[model samples]
Target chain A: MEQEKRPEEVKKTSARKWTESAKKVRGLVANMYLRAITEDKPVAWVMFTLCNELFVAMDVLPVYPENYAGLCATKRVGDPFIDRAEADGYSNVTCSYARIGLGYSALWRDTGEIPPFAPDGGMARPIMLVGSSLVCDTRYKWFQAFSRYLDVPYYAFDMPGPPAVTAHRPDVREQYMKYNLTQLHGLVSFMEERLGKKMDWDKLDEIVRRAEKSYRLWYDAYMMAGRAVPCPFPAEDSFRCFVPAFFMIGEQEALDFYQGLYDEIKYKVDNKIGSLPEERYRLLWGGGLPPWHTMGIFNYVEDRGALFVFQSVYLPLNPADIPDRITNPLERLVYSRYEMGIRRAEHDRKLGLFGACNFVGLGNPLLFVDEFKVDGVVMHWLRSCRGATIGQIYQKRLLAERSNLPVLFVESDMCDIRDYFEADWKMKFDAFLETLETRKRAGA
Target chain B: MYFAGVDIGSTMTKVVIMDEEVIASVIGPTGAEHRRLANRVMEEVLRQVNLPFDEISYVVATGYGRINVPFADRQITEITCHARGVYSLFPTVRTAIDIGGQDAKGIKISNGKVVGFVMNDKCAAGTGRFLEVIADALGVRLEEMGELSMNSRNRAKISSTCTIFAEQEVVSRISEGVSIEDILAGLHEAIASRVYRMAERLKIEPDVVLTGGVAKNIGVVKAMEEQIGFPLLIPQEPLLTGAIGAALLGKELTLKAVEGGKPVERGTRRLEEATFFE
Candidate 1:
């Protein structure tokens, strides 16, 4: 692992390692649920909060409904599930991810058998559910809705106020972190009671070390995108690259996959073999979820010789850089759980804000925009994820004014392609490219 | 020597041919054949100017069917086009409100290009279709509602967030003996309010110009003017602004290309402002 060979890895890896890592995660997810059904392994359904790695370390099979919806979407079979949820009275405005999951959950409740549309073995019935208030508050209600309908116990965890405050005092930061850490302890205790087993500290430590290594590998891999000229990857593949960071966090497979990916990407960079013929415009995807179903919309830009070097989706792999404030292995998991939000709240608090949701939605992408040498930006104004989309206009203006680069704001949905209009997006790209061309003409 | 712009809006298609001066313009309804309609507009403008299609140096297509336009040399967004067109018409214009048949937008412009903008293609309640639906409810012509609203004794209140529900509410109001004048006034007020809120999202500054087909409606225009707290500069041919802007962009693009190479890069030529949280 010579540091110098790193830049050459991009071309050597090509797109193979990325696809392989994602395929492995998809299989692992399928198998996790399969074992839960066949072997009766106790299943814990997970949400998009922090501490997912903690759940993986716990050895409980985690079933992610949100991730499952993405799979259904990728397979292009999500419409029925989404339509079924709408028919079940969850309105079309409810996120496609949540709608699809709810539809599947409702069908399971009605039939007591896997629906024909269910991917792989279908999500294993969870003995318990875990959720948190993060980027989308919809998850809080989405999970709560499932808990009530499925008749399963649900645990809601996180610090209050995004980093809770007791109203009058603004600086309850230390007390707040400890309280959140305590909540994680409560989750562990609940798991212990449910599984009827005591804690295993030594095994948890080993999992943390492996998970941290994989996470660092993921961070390093993304970092190479900026280091490599004419980024060997497309931002459309960001969701795929992040699959390991999401699912295989504690697995040796994630680390190895990322290491191979790193070497390949570096090889490409050294060979100067770019993903696009000539990456004239190195763009940064500022905010919004990648439309898993309709990523081909980017081919229009790719045709114009622009490459998206970094996406905000991959920005959450911040574990490699952040200093571990807590020495205890278990507590570090809790720290990772709430640290992002705490730092977010701290950033918000310093900037005169209160009761905010993950400002990583605002914070990290800006860092990447500069670090990636982004010549322009494309911000998706996702319709369903209101939390992320709410910052869209403000962030777009700020990015343009600050970066002094043309920004393209397009309306779309993360998992739902039905919400996308291909012509509208294409026209936007044409105009955006014109703006970039104008900037080029002005030599600005 | 010549550049053309085709704007295939949801309801109507507009074409503008320009270079140094506006040579010709055409307006027609946008039908199923977006490609056909785009070419029709191109032929219409070419016939008006007495020029062949190949004589056109470049073509920029805009609006909903922008990409669908078969003959477009390049497609541009209505947001940018509207800003550029409005700025060309009213150079001091800082904010442009475009209320089209399907989408309503508030674009903030600086230096004759869009800086920030918000568009409502999400719902029909905030667009020109809102008036169309209201007209259907009242059994009056779309153009008649404006004049009828101006004479309202007292405006009625309509509070439906959705277009269908609002239309239903209008029907019941008609049944309940509410005058059409009052209801029309209320409808204008309702749409103006929605558009105003969207404008506030972009934080409108003065020298505002109103573009798009809906700018032709005096009632909606007056209502929006009052709601936005400023008079608007309506274009001579309000619907033609996007097409005109596209043509202008096409001309500028042609000029830049003819200058031998890419646009000259000047100034500091370096930007390193990396403060993450602050």
Candidate 2:
């Protein structure tokens, strides 16, 4: 009772708990993003996950510079970014995200919004910058510049090549994986030292379990959409389903949230309450999420007696629930979840598309088409998404020849309302439908 | 007499059987495993109406997965199916935009048939996948994205032309503290711009019909309208327009086949049998 606890001891205890809390938060966030990546949950969910994780980790926020660049394009931000990057010797077409990010950085520097690292916000600076070498080589180089400029750590995750086309060449992937893992481990160790704490393996494991449960529950909800009446869960809401992915992946709270969601969805399914009006067609959707402004497609189809029964949102593999490898904790850390594997696989596929001189042919639309059994395909040709637009001709031809199915191609953006012309689309579609009827009558 | 249209899209298979008196339809996943699902959906539709499958006159199949439909009497390209579907739904439709999960097609129509079509089958940028990617990035539900987007007074521009890159871009924007509404607006505009390019290439005129999964997105519809400077005719059930057209065609064919007194083929008969119960 007479012995007073030293200030140092008190500080140590506080630091340990603080670091533990942070790890738990980061773990959950990581799990969500990892699941999104593994299951190809959606780009938005994945980004949210990443941002949350970075914030929890107390690291510099990882911004998707490309999104900002896109805004610039429509908002006239592109010109300044392009001009700035070019003036700095970056090419005009050097991955617009990089240009925009740099431009924003320059703007921030001028505005004093971003200051050098210190304990306070005004003085705090980024300690590290991370980039994935999945989409383009430009990001790799661009992040390098950031690393040098900020005088902070720069980490690049190398993605594998396509297994289908590359014949399973794992050298590049292995090298990248190893490098990324090494760097990640070092980062964690540095963080532990700075916080004067060791990682709590038990807590990490608990977080992972929560993430897995949440993912399963969300998946069950999506499955309910296949019922006759279907659930009101629109494919557009798929991103929101990943909320647990952004913040609670490895936490007990995340598990509880998902469990609750699962119960709600189960109740709906049990009640036979379809998401759309009771009608005849129970169509499945493939490809990416339908844009918000264009949600009318669901109502339009549903009104005509069709329901989106299934979708490719079910494609991602579940997170592995197996215990971490005691012998190689780093391996567990690197490949702890299946999302990373999925991301790597997708990244490789994108690389192949880029290499094939068809940078836009990144996603395999035919894969979803064949898997989902859609009666007719409505291919949304988004102007801003080159990756989804490259292989349309080939896919269409294949579908026509192989499936003898109807494919409707509509051109529009996911977010912008200005680019969609209802009158034009309606006239074309009406005639197209008429022809389908005629063909049916003619027995073509 | 009834007509039927069977559209086997990449994601799901659909069958529409329309009689002068009523219309019945069925949809299910399309795949090697879908033969049974298709049969079940068809059977269910017919069962609802207490109709016999044999009553259907003609059956036309369209879509990427159409060939897998064992019950279809004839197979037609999605282009033809959409053309027929659009024409039947809106006889005045001169142009059509059919956006599915995987591909996008812009067709010029005349007299209820496809005349000239410009399509993008190479990538998924302008397709539902693009929106899927963006929706995923924003952590918004696909269904709620449209509503949220509509709430946005400011539109954020998303420049990554590639789905993957655009996803990354979206992440960066969020981290930078850009409002989600702005990002959504930007994304919608990007999609519209792409479609506008295609329409320009196709020399699209007014009286356009917007069909497919993407047409359900109000933001995209409004964006397209703004970009093309024209009004759009959206069918009550835009996604099923192709299937509806196909069903109508099926009815016409069945009636013709019955009138001709030529015994319907086994495949046609099977489709009729499967779908007539409703």
Candidate 3:
């Protein structure tokens, strides 16, 4: 077969460009998509919330619809897909990622061919579709809908409740863990049966180790750069930095990418290089996925001299500590996932952080207001995606009650542009910056 | 020591020239090309005071087209401008609700400084534009809505979520032989309730000031007062408050710069009709 050409590059809407790791990941992801489309590798349609480490071990190239939806949005090609879905009776207020994903799938189903202009040559048709009852509520149903369109088998893994809930109920915790382990075993059997491939235990162990190292590097980079005086790694850059830990996890490339990121960030910190020329105000991206289409809003804020130092959404999951006694790779993988979830929950409980399914919200921004030295919190209140948006009002109230850190809720959708009004949003943002200036002057 | 402020809003452009007190002010419609209209409004205000452009010590721009005024020393958001403007008039004012052409915002102020604020979302509900759309559909003049609404004993209910739907509801009510006065009253009630609910987010305090083009509508002020459970203190010319505040802020900035032994950085005082070609 002839070499698959790389898709045309998407333009950067924001002033701050993606970090080096992100640029590399873009190529790697494009290659993965091309390879899967050409049937050069086994493919699995996956969601971001699931642990793709298993797919890595199985040698299946995992393609994420959520990531593709985000890309389409960033590339400004999401509107048609979203409009198509909405026209077909999908509620406009449902999860936009699901709408874009489903719409893309429908186009393929109807045409029996991938849309030529689809972002990243569109996602590869999977041998099996995967979902997780994790952070987002729309995953299982969305994947189920996709299975119907693609006529492929679908499977969903159930995540246990927050660690805070399980802390008090040991029996419930035991049952939940048992169920999760059974699901993992079932997933392995299902994969083996469907793909006619055996589990590579040693390869899985090596991958798990690599995933752990990548996660550690990601955590260290965020902690070091995130806490810097001027915040060398702003949220805009960190969003891209998340690609390695999120998509390429459990791979040697993931480890290399993060290491390079750590080195780059450390150098920036050491050289006193900041994301902005003058970071007058440090802010926390309060919660919810950003409006990918207008992500340049981050640059807009930065232009006003307010830098987003930390955000809870894209924070890396806590790396799991595997017991040395557990020699089996399967046991290690299951235990690692369970430990990551529980440990994160416990940490969040200690820090008074809000919990979201999957590992979305692990820490509270208010708790780190002093530590991060943030003067304000700007939360994107997505019209769709209720899972990320719930409790934001209460969180703002809590911020007011606990700290003087002002919270600005910028209401928009994660993918849909219709939910955003540029003039109204700019006015709101300008006013928010003024409030921050006034508060700073009054020494509040 | 003249300081001028130009406020280019979505539907109106206002300019205020002041020295210790307001000397001259101009209010005019903001046309399709607001940038050019902004210059004309500024020129008119300067003409009213019979002062050359160079005589004004500082010029500050505010409102939606705040940045478009090339001759202004600095541009401030309407939120801050409104708060400062209201606070200057009512020193004890703790909260200010400004419903403008396209958006309605509630500003929480303390000791002449803005502490917090909440504004309407992407929707035009409870905004001046919302009322205008409904009024257009009802074939009623914008200025007469307040008087007409007051005459209604039984007002019809209108949805506050979408302007188009609200207009449809108004049309349907009219088709049902409902009085236009009653429908106008309902529209006032809908907008009033929406703005009041938004202001409540800031924990509405007493001595609340209402400033904006919408405040001129007596019907809205009365409806707002009823919902807020407090009398709203409105300025003599509500539309000019942002411009007034901008001018005052410019004066303050200039004074502060001088007091700190620093140069007051300002743009060239070239007040001319603005052109897109520039």
Candidate 4:
């Protein structure tokens, strides 16, 4: 007779710890919705990519439908809205965020009241609409569709140009910056006239400065602190941490939140405290948004000793070098965004990794493989988001060529949980992990 | 020491009992009740060798219903098990494609270990179920499809990979007086091309192994070979590779434990029947 360990004892899963700032940010978001309904402040429906810090400076209640749609999905209240939108003749293949946003708005419009199950009492009705053409055309177009339901004044800025890869060309860069500057000036004028107030340049400058500091701290906490042997903060936390940065970038609370986050991460790195006790594998979330409905998938992967140490979304703004003579804060904002694009393009060109047309893909993720020292890559091939799904397959091939790392592409919609199948995902993950383990053993 | 492997797949459950060499094996359809079917199949395989359940030192379960096997010591994914089994049978095999009941997988192997894998479990368009559906629609036996396809003079084109759409297309072709053999041949070509494109993602290498219920179809194998540009090596018992690989893995684990001066971690060694409840 010989002693034997129990079958259950063979499995290993570590308990995870999330930052306090992430928890507090949820309450902060809830309050934004409440304040819009209660206060006399100008409530504006804004796009996520728009620099909403200007609204923060002006004391306007900026509501992000995109973020709210994500909230609806994560909170499990998104399905009805998605169904309603589809019933209203919105194509099933439309961007899910837009479908949900439009559906939720339609429900509110029909009843002249918040849908009973709407998250955080639903977003406050917009007094005005402000949008920018950035990231995807869907963002501004969703706002345009939204305006029809509410009969509100809508202002959209056209900031379209070449891909980020062409930003390095001086001729191309100046044209984009000049066009964006004109758009910003028009946006400011539109805001002043709509609100019946003059432009407060000093207040906007202070807000921009605060936003810069907050972003720097966010960069330190998210990127620099994550480079440890066992990462202290995982993608689950990063996904939540991005809220304050995106939703409340220029606010004092958002800045303080980052400070606390940075301190927590710094202490963890110093003490060698990792999200998992035994981190066997480090994975890069190569592309696409997290499936907000089933975030436990992150914990599931972590329990298998693989932590998602980096993601390709919600990267911090890297301001470009500008002459001291450039005093206008809006000019700096436009120039910084365009210049960052150019710099990234130039770096990708230097690596000789992509051609001119291949500007908007995971060239950065290929670089992150070496920088972050990941063992594998997992990409979510979203079903509904065609715009985001672009360049994902190409990126997977490029990753294989550049790093020889295994890439797993899981197909599912971010907001629509209907597309996900748990058993199928588990099998794929187990097989992928086995490959990683074998490669690790072989010292590949 | 005896080691047993149980595979609870969507369509069938297989069991293999081995000691140094294979001693017994059993294959049975997986019914609606997976746990019951798994237990019945395991018991039948054990009875063939006249061994009690406790006599088997280790058990490793694999397949779609792998987690449902309550008496197993470990559950490994069928992807790894298929690779290990295929590699054991064909040491030179670099790629293994397993088109099972509900899913299809492409496994990349290197020296008996899984290097990479791609799976198509999302849709029924590329699995054995697709062929089964079309075969049912054509009023033909599932097992007879390969021979029927081999008799075709001109393979009709199956434009739709979707099972529902393909079913409708097949019905239309039947009404148009096309021969059943041509329709069967076309279905094989469509599924073969879909699975080949999936396996090609791994940059498939030589000595490719084809396993699972679908591999028994000669038509599919021939069509796959045409697209892969290489002959596929299939096991003598295509359906039992996962169970065989599972048994081999259990043996390795048992030997490793014994070598380390430890007893094999055996749990739930009862030979009783199972139900959905405890």
- Give me the runs in candidate 2 sitting further than 4 Å from their true place: A1-107, A113-127, A135-154, A165-180, A186-202, A224-231, A246-248, A251-254, A280-285, A288-315, A318-330, A336-373, A414-444, B1-278
Clashing pairs in 3: A135-A357, A135-A358
DockQ of predicted model 4: 0.72
Q: Give the alpha carbon lDDT tens digit for every residue of B1-278 in model 2.
A: 66667776656667677766336766666655664457666777778777776765566777765555666777666776787788887888888998777677887777876655776635678888899888977888777766677888778878766788888898899999988978887888888788778766566887988988788888888889999898888877677877887776666555666789966553634542233224
Candidate 2 chain B — worst ten consecutive residues by lDDT sum? B268-277
- Measured over all alpha carbons after superposition, the RMSD of each candidate to the real structure, in angstroms, is 9.2, 19.9, 3.2, 6.3
Instruction: Between candidates 1 and 3, name the one with more favorable DockQ.
Output: 3
lDDT of 4: 0.82
Instruction: Give one digit per residue, the lDDT tens place, for model 3 in A184-245.
Output: 78888888998898999888888877887888899888888778886788887777778767
Predicted candidate 1 versus true structure: per-residue lDDT over A1-444, tens digit per residue: 111111111111112222234445556566656776787567888886556656666667777887888877666667767766787799777888899888877777776767755667778888889887656668888888889768898988764544323322445545655776788788888888877887687777777777777766676767876657777756766657676667556666667877866776667767876677777888888778777666565666788777787787545445523365656666766556455455544544554444353534354445666667787888888878787677766665556556766666788788776788766676667656766765676677
Q: How does model 1 score by TM-score?
A: 0.85
TM-score of chain A of 2: 0.59
Please identify which of the two predictions, 1 or 4, would achieve the higher lDDT against the true structure: 4
Q: Is the docking of candidate 2 incorrect, acceptable, medium or high quality?
A: incorrect
DockQ of each candidate, alpha-carbon based: 0.24, 0.07, 0.74, 0.72
Model 3, total clashes: 2
lDDT values for all models: 0.73, 0.56, 0.81, 0.82
Give TM per candidate: 0.85, 0.46, 0.94, 0.94
